[model samples]
Target: MPAVTEPKLIAGNANLSLAKAIARRMSMHRGMSVSLVEARVERFNDQEIFVEVFENVRGEDMYIIQSTSNPANDNLMELLIMTDALRRSSASRITAVIPYFGYARQDRRAKARTPITAKLVANMIAEAGVDRVLTLDLHAAQIQGFFDIPVDNLYASPVFALDIEHQFRGQMNDLMVVSPDVGGVARARELAKRINAPLAIVDKRREKAGEIAGMTVIGDVRGHKCIIVDDICDTAGTLCKAAETLMEAGATEVHSYITHGVLSGPAVERVQNSVMKSLVITDSIEATEKVKAAGNIRIVPTAPMFAQAILNIWGGMSVSSLFETDTLVPIYEGLYQRS
Candidate 1:
């Protein structure tokens, strides 16, 4: 009889570095040396996806990590194919670990006759035989309802809160969290609550896709260093424009902590030229060379968070408690410059 093993970690080509990071974190937990499962994912001459799992996953749980990022279609197809392969291999369960879920921005239809692509993707994953999903900071929370399988949606707030504590330790109260637009006010408000900072909103209009018409600062940002919080920063147009508007409205400086940095098209250039003091993003999506070249950008690792969630799920524990620290102290404990 073959010896039993814990869950196996597999990686698709989308974000191999993140997968390795997650494996390393898990190894620390297991107190032993372990690595990704032997799997081959490649394409044929016609660009057709091919997947073959070398290790015996029979009766073993599987977590396949793949971010549907740039070249989104190809990456997404790889994930679906891997899921199918694992299922057929007699794996007890297959979890799709999608750090950056693509088509998530199209969760709903803004115009008539447009498809709800997010829901469609969810259906595809479910149909592909995935038992569950593990992802971070989905563009819209409602997208979770699109799937019938168990979906674990993790937040990058804990990671951001820790950084916020370290970066603005002495000036917590004077730091304000601003939403780049009205739609993200709730996200900004939550971050503000976490750090005990004030909340502000940028009243902006979206005249067309990927464009912001104008914005007005709804709250006082004067003399305060502001941090804008949002779920995604694709083109950086909204964030750059918001930073300029905040500075014009008397903000001392402007920064941003966005969960997913799609950073497509002219995003890197815009952020480099923008007045924003810094732009912090999670490594949910692989950062491009241009994003790395941008001087003001910082990346926070999410692998540990994902690794912990995976452990909790495999152990049948609640994943929500990971956000809370051991001291039972409020996440906002810090000296206040305002006081």
Candidate 2:
């Protein structure tokens, strides 16, 4: 009998390193097992991002990995156009794997005259003919319900937890996972549970976008190593302020773990000289040269988890097991072999 059709992995003009890493994790031959067309994205005279698919994807299961990070609107538009092209080419299925979903913070209308840009982005993606969405660390979990298609929200906490365990094998007891704000308590709690450490929350008020004011330490941090957990660190104002607060509260040391590192404006300099001992971020959004060069910054990989999710979804297996780590021995073995 003839074999069944194989799943195809496609890449857009975003974070090539992350895409390549994800492809490697799947144990698939690069650009051989799939029709990953090179998207020649360019800017127009009007400063609009232009994109063109270089190869055919007709009747193929196309999975495009593009993060709407830097150049948020341009990258987002590129993804939409790529999906439209795949749809026009009659691709069997198209899954948008966006690691860092930009504009997600605008999920709700915070002010009377503001727009819900996140919802608008979600609607645009769905209208662009995306069959499903595969993203990580959304700015707000509630944004998932905004999409009609199935959205697999992956967690970088699992990967971060593993790294923490590997790095601080014996000093786990000294750790105190801290949330930089009330909204991040859930994220910090999960990581704290994984590491078996106490959790703390930072109470803060934001005066304006990219500016945080009046940070207060909610829980005791005296002589305890603090690890601030947040979803995105854009200008580093909140993180820097929280780190400063933690230090003043007699924290033995202050470290921060965030999934998306937007690092806009003068963030690199701020983080470099902050009271933060270390600032770990996932490679969801591609880091700039300046951001990467900062001595206090560290990058963690989420490629393996996404790759496994892709494998499970392709193989018609249960990806739900991804949420349960106590029984993750087999998957780790599988990862070891694949890696």
Candidate 3:
């Protein structure tokens, strides 16, 4: 039998902490020894980006872990340059591991003369010589179709469902999973099914970007502790409004679990003043200081999930099983059995 070689991990500056965490998990995996391939990503005096891989990756599989977050353009350019560098270094496979794929929200043209930026971003990654893409909870799942290369769209529902089970445990009946809008109903329904909770939708009309014109609850949330589920929370205008609407509909308490917490502009301030009991988000995108200081906000690390997915992909194992959603009965049974 031929000896197997470990895939080289590369980190970009988009989210160093997350990248490091994934690296640590890789190193800790039994029978697997992995390390990040050293690389220098800097800029010239004229503000041009430069990337140089120090290690020889000839014919080796390499995965570049980056999140196109806050500085979207800079981080995106860095990823593309890093991919091109790895390609030039003769890496057999270059997978762009983007935890928070920026510009994913612009997957469609909402109006005439508008650009479908997500498709363009996908094209850029492919043109940069990437063989595959691995990302989490894209705003639009169809963005995967935009990429010519193989793209794995991982879901955060498993993590959130496990947490929900732990938090609500015996009180699952009191919980109601909610979709902030019709578009997110599918996501919220999956979460609701996992927790064995009823589902509700907040029918909202968007008159302008980053703002909601009006919102109406589509189902009864009266006396239920509602949990709104969504893929992203950018300005937080919609989430805050949905929480308020739920409260007005007699929901006992409103909580939320979002995959990506962009939290741009006045998001933190709005979340602070919202009627939500708490807002839990995944650390797909690095959290800002304001998000860190917010009393009502909590961040859950998603590094373990990503780490497992990366390992599975490198080992040629199935990644779909990693996203299997949990149900209340099984969770309860396992918990009791463990005790």
Listed in order, each prediction's TM-score against the native is 0.94, 0.91, 0.94
**Regions of model 3 farther than 4 Å from truth:** 1-3, 31-33, 208-210, 325-339
**True-vs-predicted CA distance for residue 178, candidate 1, Å:** 0.4
lDDT of 1 by residue, 1-339 (tens): 222558789999999999999999888877886699999999999999999999899899899999999999999999999999999899998899999999998988888999999999999999999999999988888899999998989877767877787787778878999998778877788788788888999998878876677899999999999999999998888789999999999999999999999999999989989999899999999888878888999998887788888888888888787665422123223421122
lDDT by residue (75-149, candidate 2, tens digit) is 898899888878988887889999999889899987799999998999999999998998998888999998999
Best of the two (1, 2) by lDDT = 1
TM-score of 2: 0.91
Candidate 2 RMSD to the correct structure = 3.2
Model 1, residue 317: what's the lDDT?
Answer: 81
Clash total of candidate 1: 0
Candidate 3 lDDT score at position 333: 36
